[model samples]
Every structure is written in structure tokens, then in C-alpha cells.
Target chain A: MKLKELAHSRTGDKGNISNVSLIVYHLEDYERLRQAVTAERVKNHFKDIVKGEVIRYELPKMGAMNFVMQEALGGGVTRSLSLDRHGKSLSSYLLEMEISLES
Target chain B: MKAIRIGGGAGYAGDRIEPALDLMEKGNLDYIIFECLAERTIALAQKEKQKNPSKGYNPLLEYRMEKVLPLCVSKGCKVITNMGAANPVGAARAVKEMALKMGLQNLKIAAVTGDDVFLNIEQYLDSTIMETGKPLRERYPDIISANAYIGAEGIARALKEGAHIIITGRASDPSLTVAPLIHEFGWEWTDYERLGQATAAGHLLECGAQVTGGYFAEPGYKDVPELWNAGFPISEFSENGDFTVSKLDEAGGLISKATVKEQLLYEIHDPENYLTPDVVADFSQATVEEISANNIIIKGISGKQKSSYYKTSVGYQDGYIVEAEISYGGSGCMNRARLAEEIVRKRIAYTDLSYEELQTDFIGTSSLYGEQTSTNLIPEVRLRVAARCEERKEAMAIGQEVEALYTNGPAGGGGVRVHVEEVISIASILIPEANVRVDVVFEEL
Candidate 1:
């Protein structure tokens, strides 16, 4: 199964850093999300775009996790040569990450 | 027992004004905040100010004020905005003049200034830029604008002085909401806990409709009804710091736990230490509950003392960005687009265009993800070529190469479009709060 089945996400950018928040549809799925979506996994998932380190912050009460990817916007929006300078589409790309449902 | 209703009006410089008008007319709000300044908006406005002395503020200031002021005057609701961009005093004067013309009397408009620190930028040349990890002196010559993110103090002062309309430049977005709350509730600057909660409310409301289903529509997965006419957010905040995020009853959007939770973490990196000029708000423990239809209460937010330094945004003239796009459709479109991309790349290399960076993207297949993810044959694809070059003439070659492909290279290539724009890139630096002297100048009509 894909992560999109269990959660939805939103992408926000500040300079070259892009932060994508993944929130579970149900609170019970939060623990499974935390176990599956590791910072290493996220960094590896966006290895093509992100050049710097990836830091993840967990909010168990809110059933969400925020992944902060540095050097992700190709040197920020104002200077980036990419079509989507802000990398707003990154959230959807993150949602496409495959998640193993057999646990 | 006292609570103030604050409406988030305009989110950005180009945000729609109708929803704000709807809020003013129907929401019955005490204060309406139009948070318009973006990271690079002030820098662009500074360039506009270089050409015209009195035209540095938001272009829609008059258009918005003309509609909002009359309603505010009649309804007795105050207005707050960072629409001033690069010129708060000029913006205030313009609003005063417009109010006079509209026969609106007894209006006290305040313009908060001193955010622009370009004249004294030399003093901070030795400081290290937060983003690039280099001294500001490296980009000193190219620096076009430098403005500190001023806090809620100046805005609260303006509100306390009974300024019906307040205009500011580069004030932190959340401070727009926090300022009014401080004035009405008389919250102390040292009250980090309340300030944190208020800042959370401001952050949720800062993006206008983002909290009210504007950005969260995924059809069957996460469906938001009437998103086209989504109402702007309104916060019914109390003195104790907790607030309820709601919209007008007749407005077209849902205020559910999901919408509120998504917005809570938007653009936030460290949930525990979300820094603003006013306070370092902590939203890590924040939770949302839907008590009624269109009303979600947010709680468990706190804050720490603010940092001694203010985060400043420095805009510099980076270079020129040239972008060109040509679409190919019908049979064999993918191959034609790929061939067009290759041709443009070879043409730029052959012409020896001096550029800092360049990229080619097939819009349908690999523009966003940078690789072909799907195996299905694409019927139509757009070839986009973009480059950043030091010289304007050099930047134009990238677009020219793409345009040439319409006749010279690709079959079925159509809708060729080219754009050349100057890049005003932004860098961040920290300035001592003492150096940024904020003052509010009031103009009466």
C-alpha cells in the first residue's frame, strides 16, 4: 500500500529548505506511520532532489510527522532554475512513497 | 470573559479580496488582518520604490482599503496589515487620502516604519548569513534591500493609540494577529505562555483560507465542499490564550479537526521551537477539537522568551532567469519533446551561453520528479528550458533556443512561450533587536 492510503501531506518551503507534514487519517495509524516513515527513509526517498540532511519531528498527539529537507529547493525559490522553485509538489511525491501494510 | 474575533483577510499580496469583504460584512469581527508581505515581496517592492517615490506599498492597498475602510468605519472594526511592503508611511498617507475622498471621517491611520535597515547595512557586514554560512560582506555590493522582521510591539502600540487602520512593512505575519490580541487583552510581553498560544492562532489564521479547506482538497481521499468559494478563517480568541478557528456561517468551507491539524504544522520545522519576532511559540503539544460545525478549538500551545536578535531578510540582485516552454501533442509527442530538449541543450552549449545554472525538463514526464515515474506513453508533453545567467543578453539565448525548436527541431511543437525575468534572491541574517528601532507614525483623516 502507499502512504497516501493511510495519511495526507502538505509541503511548505522556506528558502532552500522544504518541510512536508504527514498526518494520519486515524489516530490509531499514527504509531504505524512513525515506525514506517523514518528520516533515513525520507531522505532516501527524495535523494534525487534533497542534497542536505533530513530531520524528522514527530507529533504523536496530532498523529503527524514533519520532515524538514534542507537544500531541497535547488537553492531556494528566487534563485532556483527548477520549474517548481518552491518544491510545492514534494508533498505529493512523498505521498507516493510505498508503505508495507503487512505488520 | 472577554473574547475578540479576528479575521485573517488577505494571505499574500495577490490574494482575493472578496472573501475578506465577506468576512468584514458577515463575520462581525473586531479586527481584520491582511498579511500580505512574503519573503521576496518586500525586495521587489524596494525596486519599485527606486523608480517611484510614493509607490512602494502593496499595489492593491488602495483597492482593498477603499472596500475595507468603509465597512470598518461603519462596523467599528479595526484593520491591520503589513501591506505597506517597503513603504508604510506612504501607504498610510495614501489610505488617509483615499478615506478623505470617500468622505470617511475620524479615521486614525498608523504607519509603522524602521523595518528597512539598508542604509545601515554596512554595520552588519561582518555578521554571518544564516542560510549561506558566509559573511554578509560577500553580497554587500549586490544587496538591494534589507528589512528586519519587526515584532508585535510596534503594532500593539499602534493599536493602543486607537489607530483604526495600521500599515507596516516586514512585520512578522503572526504579529498582525498577536498585536490586536495584546491590545485588547493587555497581555504582557513577558507572558510567553499566552503569547505562544496567540502566535499559534495567528499562524493558523495567517494563510487565510489554508485552514478552511482552500489547500486541502483531495477528492475522495479528503473532500472539501465548495472549496471554490472557501471562506477566510476567523479566530475567536480569549484572554486565556486558547482560540477557536471558525468562519462565517454562510461561507463555503469546513472547519474540521483535519483542516486545523494540517495548518498547525504548515511551514513549521521544529514544532517545539517555532520562532517568531514576538515569541518562540511551541506548537508541539497543540491539539484541535471540533466542538460544533465550522468551529474547531485549538489548545495546549505554549511559548518561550523570544530571541534577542531579529531575523532579517536581505534581497540581492542575483541575475536573470530565462524560461521558455514549447508543448508537443498528438502521436509521438514524448519523443518530439525529448528531441526538443536535447536540441536546446546542445544549442546552448554550442552558442556558449554564459549561465550560472541551467536545466531542461519535460513537463509531463520529468519536470517535477526529475525522472520518468510512469511507464505509460504520454500523448502530450511540454519541453521547458530555463537558465540563470549574469547578463540579460545571455539569459535570452536559452529562451531563443527553445523558440527555435518550434521550426528548427521538433515536429508538432506548438504554444511556444518565453519569459526573461531578473532574479532578486533573498538571504537571511540576524540583527540585534535594539538596532531595529520601530516607530509608528499616525495620519488622521
Candidate 2:
């Protein structure tokens, strides 16, 4: 399954950090999913948009990973959490990455 | 088969050695486990590893081991720990050297690695996306760390090999205990229900005495004895998948339903679906009641079939970051931080500068938002703002703007302390067990 569909939504703060708490039915698949995506690769993929710093944290036990795309959130404390003027969540945008591995 | 005995240990850092040692001594336990990783702690470990790869793995772990391992070795006990950070092999070698120094050459120590999948990061990025079935490069690039949180089986293998000490880099918290059980019981991988119960026991004791009144202790704190040093949780598992959670007698902490409940809730999501490599355990069927002082028996935990994946805890060197705490003074002490955040945001917008992340904090201020829709008070707020970005220049720009806000904003320059920034882009990855395999070999002293 895709991260967006599994996690529902994601949130990225000014630090280029994105967090999505999710549930995976099969516990065995946790590690495979993690190996498929990496923080550096995630940052490099968005190197243009996420020009500052990029970090990722994984809670394998919980089957979750958090990506911190530093400075990607428009100076952080001043910008809005909403995706647009209509206050749409940015989780969908963040989950747009089509990544998979041998899970 | 004989009942399996397991204990889980965790501390604020690595200073809780006395109680840990005491518990081993008093309980005459078979296995002792410890967990010592947080986000910041991982970052710190990574830095230390970069400087001296041999000197990471939570500094306190080596010190504590130096103090207790000899005694543990003399008593013919085994220890399994995740103290092996970026340098599991290095840490294991250190222990071997320590053993040599003590003239105890029979220490048959083993270190389990290969779970760190960082080497395969490029492969992952270059692979296809699961949902869209598109090439990964078509979407994202540059992943940080990719590691597998191997199950207890690796540690169990070390135990089976007759190693008195085992060091691993990132195994599940509950896996510590499950490893011993798997080693002892000769359980099959497909026996998910049995492994699930073992995992539950480890989870209960993973936080040490936290399940026994460390963090969640209340008014009974004064009455509790041996406050100076407390005992971690140990379990006695039977072949039937039943286990009792308890601590050594005369130890400082108290084990009861309240304490166990607190630790159960620690780092958990749905109680109904507590996930593990072996099986998904449902805490709903479990009950914690005080069997005696510093002891709570865990009963009736049902387990389901195992999952297909092993959780991966991969970390990578994304870039460097600097943190500075700017104090806001007087009525708007918090506002000063907020205003600084605003200024930095505006400045970054104007510049081509970008940061991986930046974080700011108002040290002494309110941390909560109003619970109700409209609750009124002359609220005193302190903004603890921080951000992480990839571009060091952007981070510097954000830092400069935050500092500049103090010159013209409320309570100008009351106090500011810039915390050192380091490479903070270690990320976690999840992979299927079928994809990554565990390899173990015996090493002589």
C-alpha cells in the first residue's frame, strides 16, 4: 500500500520535518517498508524544494517514519499548517512520493 | 521444558547501573535487557561515531558494563542490549578487550549486525514505488538511514552459542526477551502466538522499573522503600506462554497495575494491536495485579499470527543543524520567541537560503493551548520553536533572524543560548523479513 493511503495524512513543519503515524497489518513487513525508504534519499529527492536540512526518524516497532525536511516549511513559525488559503492539509502533498522496496 | 526467565532494563541514560546490577544479583535471572535510544540520543551517538566510531553506543553503557559485567560473568549470566549504536562491532570488541584486561578470556561474546541497511539506500531509491508502481527516482531521492529492527532471534542465537554477553544494533524492545525464549524453547518462526506472548512480556519490562513506578509513581512515593536505587522488571515465562512481571525483593520501585499500565502505554498506539515481528498481541486480554511489593503478574495476553516485516531503524547523515534558545522577557516573554520566528520566516522567504530544520524555544513559559473553545486568561506563553532544514546557510539565516528579532522586539536580548548543531538526518525504514536476512556466527574469546 502507499504511504498516503496507509497514513491518511502527513504534517511537515518548518524544519522540513514530516510525521505520519500509521498502522501496518503485518508486523513482518515493517522492516521491508523501512528499507525501501531512507531519510537521505527522501531529502535528496526533494533537494530542490527542501534546500535546508533533511533528517528522518523511524519507529519500526510502531511501523512509522518521520521525515524532517529542514527549512522546507517556509521559515516555520510564521507559515500556516494549511496547504492553501482554504486550509487543506499538506499530508497528501508530502505522501506524493511513489517509493517501494522488497516488503 | 524449563520456564524461561527474562528481565528488561531502561534508564534516563546509562546511570541506573546499581539497580540493574542489584536486580540481576537478587533475582538470579537468566537474561537482562536494556533500551537507550531517543531521537536526540541517536543524533548524539551518530556524532560520537563520526568522530570515533569505536566510542558511540551510549557512553554510559560501557561504563556500566565495566562495573557489572565481571560480576555478571562470574555468576554465569548473559546480557543482551541495544547499546551498540552506529558501532556494534566496536562496542563488542571493547567488551572483549575489557574481558581480556580482567584476565577472563572465557567471555565468548557475540555481536549481531547486518541489520543496518544504509548500504542498500541507493537500491531502495532506485527501486519501484509500491502503490504507484513507478520508479522511486520518479518521486524522491537521497534517503538517510535504513536499518532493520531484528527480532529476538538474533540475540537468542548468541545465547544458544553460549555467549555470556550479546550486543546488537537495534532490536525490538520486546525482542530482547523473546530471543532468549526462542533460544531456549526452540520455537518455530511460524509460532507467532507463542512469540507474541514473549514479546508482550518484554514490552512490560522494556522500560525497566518504569512499569514499576519510575515515571508514573504517585503519593505512595514517600512510603516506597529503597528510593535511592530501584529495580527493573524481570519476567518468568512458562512453556504455556504465561509470564509474571516482578522486580527483586527490597528494591526501590513498586510493581502494580498502575505502574505496568503506564509502561504499557509508553510508545504504544492501539492497545488492541500491539505489533511485533512474531505476532500482534492484544493488551485488552491482559491484566496487571500486584502479586506482592514490586511485583505485578501479567496474565491472559492473547497473541495473533505474525506479520511479514521486520521494522527497520535506519539512520543517515543528512546534514548539520544549529539550535539557539532565545529568551523572551516580562509579559510577552514568549511573544519575543514568536516574533523571532516570524522574522526568520520572512527573512528565509526573501533569501534563497533553506535549512533541513530549525527549532526555537522559550525556556520558561506555558506549553499548552486552551482545552475549551473560549477560555480566557492573560496567558503567559513561551514559544519553543525549532526547525530542521538541509541547507546550512538557510539554518544560519534562520538563526541570524531569530537573534535579530531580539534587538527590536519585546524584552530585547533577555537571554540566548545557541545549542550546537550536528548532522541530524537519521531516518527509520521498514522492510520485509523476506528481503533482509540475519546471519550469525560464533566467535571465540
Candidate 3:
């Protein structure tokens, strides 16, 4: 299963920093996410776009996780020359992450 | 027993005004705050104000006020807004005149100023750009607008003065709601923990309908009903700083823990220390619970402390941005799109149209996930070319080159759209909080 099967994501940008929040549909799936979605994997996934470090923060209360990508946007919404300056589609990219279902 | 219901009106400068009107009509609210100013919006507004002294406020100020003022006055709901982008006094005056014209004779409007540092530009003569750490004098010839993000003290003072509508210039977006929470709850400025909770509520509600499932709908997977008529958010802030987020009755949209959680982390840098003009909010410990259908309770928020300096947003003339798109389809669309891309690049290769940065991407094929994502060729694709230049005509020429691909090249190219926009970029720096002073003046009609 893909992350999209159990979660939905949203992207927000400020300057060159971009934060993508992943919210799971079921609380039972959070442990699966905690085991699968590691910060190193996220940093490796966005290594092409983001120039700086990727930090992941856990929110067990809301069953959500925030991945902060530094230097993710080309420059940002204001300074980036890319078509998707705000990187709004980046959330969809995070949702593309594949997750193994619990047997 | 001290509780106030406030609605988030306009999130951005050009967000839907009808939702705000609907919020006022049906939300049973005591106050509605419209957070309309973005980082670069004030610079653009300053350009307008330089052109016309009486203008430079929000573009939809009259239309929004004309639609909501009558209802707000009747309900006695206090209105707080940062629609006074470059000119608070002018916005207040505009609102006052509109109220009188609408036969609302007893409206009391207040304007908060002292955010702009144009009058004291010399103080930053030796200052450095916060992002790049470069000297300010070396970058650009002009600084369009240098305004600091202020706190909620002036707004609380305005409410104490009995102003029904408070218009502000360059105030922090969250402070618009935080101010009202302070005034109504009699919370002190030094109450960091309580202020953080209120700031969290303000942050949750500042983006209008964003926290109420408007931006959370994804159709099949994350489904939401009646998204077309999605209602804006309204928060009931208690004296203890706990709040319930909900919308108007019979309005569309969902307000569950999922929506609130997505919003809680929006654009936030550090969850342990979220900085604002008012407080250093820590939402890490905050608890969210769904108490009813389309209503969630948010509580347990805390704060560290606020910094002694305020963040100043400075706008400058970066350059001009030009974008042109040409779509190709039918038989050999991807090939034609590639040909179109090459043609645009070659045509503008040797011209005087010097661009600082240029980018190209195929919309249907390689826009987001890169070229590796699409193994099979698509039937259709959009070839988009964007360039940043120092001159308007040069930027326009970049578009003209792409538009020429219809007759000059590309067999199946159709639907050519081009845009040339002024790029007013922004930078930030911090200054002493004590250096900036805020004053609230009222006007009655």
C-alpha cells in the first residue's frame, strides 16, 4: 500500500523552507508510519530538490508527522523561478511514498 | 464565563469575501478578523499609495465592507482587520465613509499605525539583510516598503476605546485574533503560556477556511462534502485560553482532528518554539479532540518567551517574471512540445533579453515527479518556459518567442497563454521591539 492509502499530506512554504504534514486516516496505521517513514528516507527521497537537511517531528497525539525540508523550494514562492514556486505539489510527492501493509 | 466567538474572514489578500459575509450572517460571532496582508503585499500596496495618497489599502476593501458592514453593525460584532496594507488611516477613512454612505451612522472605526519604517530608513543604514547577511546598500537601489510585524497591544487598546472596527497596517496576522482574545478575556501581555494558547488559536483560525477542510479535501481518499460551499472557521476562546473550532450552522465542510492537526503545523518552523510578535508558542504539547460533528476542541498549548526584537519585512525590486505555455496534443504531442521548447530557447538565445534565471518543464510529463516518473509517453503535454529579467519588454519578448511557436514551429501546438508580472521580492531583518511604537486612533461617522 502507498502512504496515500492511509494518509493525506499538505505542503507549506516559507522562504526556502518547505514543511509537509502527513496525517494518517486510522490511528492503527501510525505505528506503521513510525516504522516505515524515517527522516533519512524522506531526506533521501527529496535529495534532488532540497539542498539542506530534512528534519522530522512526531505528533503522536494527532497521528501526524511533519517533515521540514530546508532549501526545498528553488528559492521560495517569491524568489523561485520554477513554475511551482510554492512547491504545492510536493505534498502529492510525499503521498507517493510506498508503505507496506500490516499482515 | 468570559468567552468570545471570532471568525476568520479573509485569509489572503484576494480570498473569497462571500465566506466572510456568510460567517457574519450565520456564525453567531462577536468578532471577525481578516488577515489579508502577506510579506510582499505591502510593497505592492506602497507602490499604489505612492501613486494615490487616498488609496493603497486593500483592493476589495469597499466591496467587502459594503457587503458586511450593515450586518456587522446590526449584530454589534466587532471587526478587526489588517486590510490597511500601506495605509491604515486611509483604510479607516474609507471604511468610515462607506459606513456613512450605507446609512450606518454610529460606526466607530480605529486605525493602528507606526509599522512602516520609511520615515526612519537612515537607522538601517548599516544594517544587513537577514537572509543573506549582505549589506543592504549593495543589493538594490530602492527599498519599496520596510514594515515590522507588530503585536496585539494596539488592537486591545482599540477595543478598550470602544471601536467597533479596527484597521491596522503591517500587524502580524495572528495578532488580529490574539488582540481580541486579550481584550475580552483581560489577559495580560506577560502571560506567555496563556498568550501562546491564544496565539495557537489565532494561528489555527488565521487562514480562514484552511483549517475547516477547505484545503483538506482529496475526493476519493480524504473525502469532504459540499466543499463548494465550505464555511470559514470560527473559534470560541475561553478565559482559560482553550478554544473550540467550528463553523456556521448548515454550512459545508468538516472540522475534525485531522483538519486541525494539518493546520497546526502549517508554515511552522519549530513546533517547540513557534515565534511571533506576541509569544514564542509551543504547540508540541497541545491536545486536539473532536467533541461534536464539525467541531473540535484545542487545548494544552504552552509557550517559552517572546523575543525582544520584531521581524521586519523589506520589499525591493528584484526583476520581472515572464511565463508562456503552449500545449500540444493529437498524434505526436510530446515530440512537438520538445521542439517547441528548443525553438523558444534558440529564438531568445542571442537577443538583448538577458534573463537571470530560466526554466523549462513539461506539465503532463515532467513537471512534479521529474522525467523518471513517466516511462510511457503521454498523448498530450504542456511546454512551459519561464524567465526572470530586469526589464518588462524583455520579459514580454520571452513570452512572444513562445507564442511564435504556433506558426513558426510545433505541428499540434495550441492554447498559447503568456503572462508578464512584476516581481517585487522580499527580505527580512530584525530590529529592537522598543524602537517601534503603535497608536490606535478612532473615527466615527
Candidate 4:
């Protein structure tokens, strides 16, 4: 299954960093999300785009996780030559991350 | 327990004004905030100021003020905005002039200045730029604009002085919403908890429609109704700091727990350390509950003492970027697009166009993901070539090379478009709070 089945995400950018927040649809799925979507996994998922380190912050109360990717947005929005300067569509790309369903 | 109703007017510099006008007309707002300045917008505005002294503010200030000023005056609603960009005084002056022309009286317009730190750039020459980890002196000559992200103190002071409209340059986006809360409730600068809560409310409202269903829609997954005419957000805050997010009943959009939650963490890195000039707001334990349709209560947001230094955005001339696109269609369109990309790259190298970096992308297949994208032959594809160069002429050559593909190469190529724009990149640095002094100048009409 894909992470989109249990979660939705939103992407925001600041300078060369892009932060994507993944929120679970239900609180019950939060634990599973926390286990599956690690910072290492996120870093690997965006290895091509993000050149720097990825730091993940947990919002357990809100059943969400925030991933901050440095050296993203192709060196920031104002200077980047990328088509999507802000990398706003990164949330959708993150949603495509495959998640193994709990048996 | 008096609750003050505040409406988010414009989210960014070019946001729609209709929703804001709707708030003033029907939402019964005590204050309306327009958070218009983005990270690099003020820097670009500075370039404009250099060319013309009188014009550095948001270009839409007159058009927006002309429409909302009368409504605000008649309804006794105060206005706050960072639409001043590089020049708050000029923006305030423009608003005062427009208000007088519109025959609106008893309006006290305040221009909050002192955010611009270019005059005292020498003092920060030794400071390290957070982005590049380099000394400020390294990029001193290339620096175009340097403005410190000021707190709500100046805005609160303006409100205290009975300013009907406040214009500011480079104030933190959330501070636009937080200022009125401080003024209304008389919250002290040292009150970290209340400041934190207010900052959360401001953050949620800062994006306007983002918390009201504009960016929350997903066709089959998370459906939002009437998103086309999605309304901007309005929050009612009690003196104690708890607030409820909602929109006009007749307005289009959703204000569910989901929308609010998504926006709560939007652009935020750590929920616990969401830094603003006013406070270091903690949203980790914040709770969102749907009290009713289009009404959600946000609570449990706390704050800590703010940092001693103010985060400053330094804008410099990065160079020029030229982007050119051409579409191809047919059975082998993907191959044709790749061929065009190769042709452009070879042509640029052959012509010796001096560029720092260059990239070629097939729009439909791999423009966004690059090499990671799966290659599948598609019926149509758009070939896009973009290059960054120090000189404008070098940037123009890349675009010209792409445009030449219409008649020079690729079968069935059509709809070629090219754009060459000067890049104004931003860097972050910190300045001591004491070094930056904020002053509010008032103009009464």
C-alpha cells in the first residue's frame, strides 16, 4: 500500500530547505506511520532532489511527522532554475512512498 | 471575555482581494491583516526603490487599499499589512493619498520603518550568513537589500497610537496577525505563553485560504467543496490566547480539523520550535477540534522566550536564469523531445555560452523528478531547457537555442516559449535585537 492511503501531506519551503508534513487520516494509524516513515527513508526517497541532510520531527498529538530537507528546492526558490521553484508538488511525490500494510 | 475577530486579507503580495472584501463586509472583523511580503519580495522591491525613490511598495497597494479602505473606515475595522515591502513610508503615503481621494476621514495611517539594515550593513560585516556559512563581507558588494524580520512591537505601538491602517516593510508574516492580538489584549512582550498561542493563531491565519480549503483539495482522497471560490480565513481570539478558525457562512470552502491541522504545520520544520519574531511557538501539543461546520477551535499552543537576535534576510544578485519550453506530439514524441534536448545542449556547448549550470528536462516524463523518473514512451512531451549564468546575454543564448529547435530540429514541434529573468537570491543572518530599532510614523487623513 502507499502512504497516501493512510496519510496526506503538505510541502513548504524556506530558502534552500523544504519541509513536508505528513498527517495521518486517523490517530490509530499514527504509530504505523511513525514506524514506516523514518528520516532515513525520507532521505533516500528524495535522494535525487535533496543534497543535504533530512531531519524529522514528530507531532504525536496531531498524528503527524514533519520532514525538513536541507539543500532542497535546487538552491532555494529565487535562484533555482527548476520548473517548480518552490517544490510545492513534493508533497504528492512523498505520498507515493510505498508502505507495507500491517498484517 | 471579549473575543476579537480578525480576518486574513491577503496571504501573499498577489493574493485575491475579493475574500478580504467579503470579510470586511460580512464577517464583522475588528481587524484585517494582509501578510504580503515573501522572503525575496522585499529585496526585489529594493531594486525597484533604487530605480525610483517613490515606488518600492507592493504594486497592488493602491488597488487593494482603494477597494478596502472605505469598507474599513465605515465599519471601524483596523488594517495591518506588510505590503510596504521595501518602503513602508511610501506605502503609507500612497494609502493616505488614496484615502483622501476616496473622501475617507479620521484615518490614522502608520508606517513602521527601521527594518532596513542596509544603512548599517558595516556593523554586521563580521556576522556569518546562516545559509552559506560565510562572512557577510564575502557578498557585501553583491548585496542589494538587507532587512531584519521585526517583531510585533512596532505594530502594537502603531495600534496604540490609534492608527487605522499600518504598513510595514519586512515584518514577519505571522506578526501581522499577532500585532492586533497584542494591541487588543494588552499582552506584554515578556508573556511567552500568550505570545506563543497568538503566534500559532497568526501562523494558521497567515496563509489566508490555506487553512480554509484552498490548498487542501485532493480529487478522490481529501475532497473539499466549493474550492473554486474558497474563502479566506478569520479567527476569533479570546483575551487568554485560545482561538477558533472559521470563514463566512455564505463563503465557499471548508474549515475542518484536517484543513486547520495541515495549515498549522505548513512551512513549519519543528512543531516545538516554530520561530517568529514575537515568540518561539510550540505547536507539537496543539489540538484542533471541530466545534461546528466551518468552525474549528485551536488550543494548547504554548511559547518560550524569543531569541536575542532577529533573523535577517539578505538579498543579493545571484545571476540570471533562462527557461525555454517546446512541445512535441506524435508516436515518438518522447524520443523527439530527448533529441531536441541533446541538440540544444550540444549547440550551447558549441557556441561556448558561459553558464554556471544547465539542465534539460522532458516536461511530461521527467521534468520534476529528473533521472529518478521512470522512462515510458508517451504520446506527447514538452522539452524544457533551463540555464543559469552570470551575464544576461549568456542566459538569453540558452533560451534562443531552445527556441531555434522549432524550425531547426524536432518534427511536429510547436508552442515554443522562453523566458529570461534576473535572479535575486536570499540569504539568512541574525542581527541583535538591540541593533534594530523599529519606529512607527503616523499620517492622519
Give candidate 1 misplaced runs (Cα > 4 Å): B372-376
| iRMSD for every model | 0.9, 12.5, 1.5, 0.9
lDDT of 2 by residue, A1-103 (tens): 4654333223423122333223233446557656766777666555534455655555444445555454454322222121221112333444555656445
Off by over 4 Å in 2: A1-103, B11-15, B38-56, B126-141, B218-228, B317-322, B329-383, B405-407, B426-429
User: Each prediction's Cα lDDT score?
Assistant: 0.91, 0.60, 0.86, 0.90
Off by over 4 Å in 3: none
Residue B316 CA error for candidate 1 (Å)? 0.4
Tens digits of lDDT, candidate 4, B1-445: 9999999998788999999999999999999999998999999999999999999999999989989899989889899999999999999999988988888889999999989999888788898988778898887789999999998999999999999999999999889888988888887788998998888888888899999998889999889888988999999999877899999998999999889889998899888998888899999998888889999998899999889999999998888999999999988888888899889989988998888888777888887877787577577889888888999999988898888987898898999999999988888899999999899999997
Clashes of 1: 0
What shift in Å separates residue A18 of candidate 3 from its native position after superposition? 1.1
Clashing pairs in 1: none
Name the candidate, 3 or 4, with the larger TM-score value. Answer: 4
Q: Is the docking of candidate 2 incorrect, acceptable, medium or high quality?
A: incorrect
Each candidate structure's TM-score, on Cα atoms with residue i matched to residue i, is 0.99, 0.71, 0.96, 0.98
Error of 2 at B190 (Å): 3.5
TM-score of chain A of 2: 0.63
Give the DockQ of candidate 1.
0.83
Query: For model 3, how does the per-residue alpha-carbon lDDT over B1-445 read when each residue is reduced to its tens digit?
Result: 7789999997788899878888898888999999999888898999999999999999989988888899888887889999999999999999988887878877889999989987776677567876667777654566788899999989999999889999999999889988988888787788998889888989988898898887789888767888888889999988777899998867888888889988998988678888999999998877899898988999889986799998888888888899899998877778778888988888888675689999888988887756646644577889989888989999999999998888898686889999999998877878888889888888997
Clash list (residue pairs), candidate 4: none
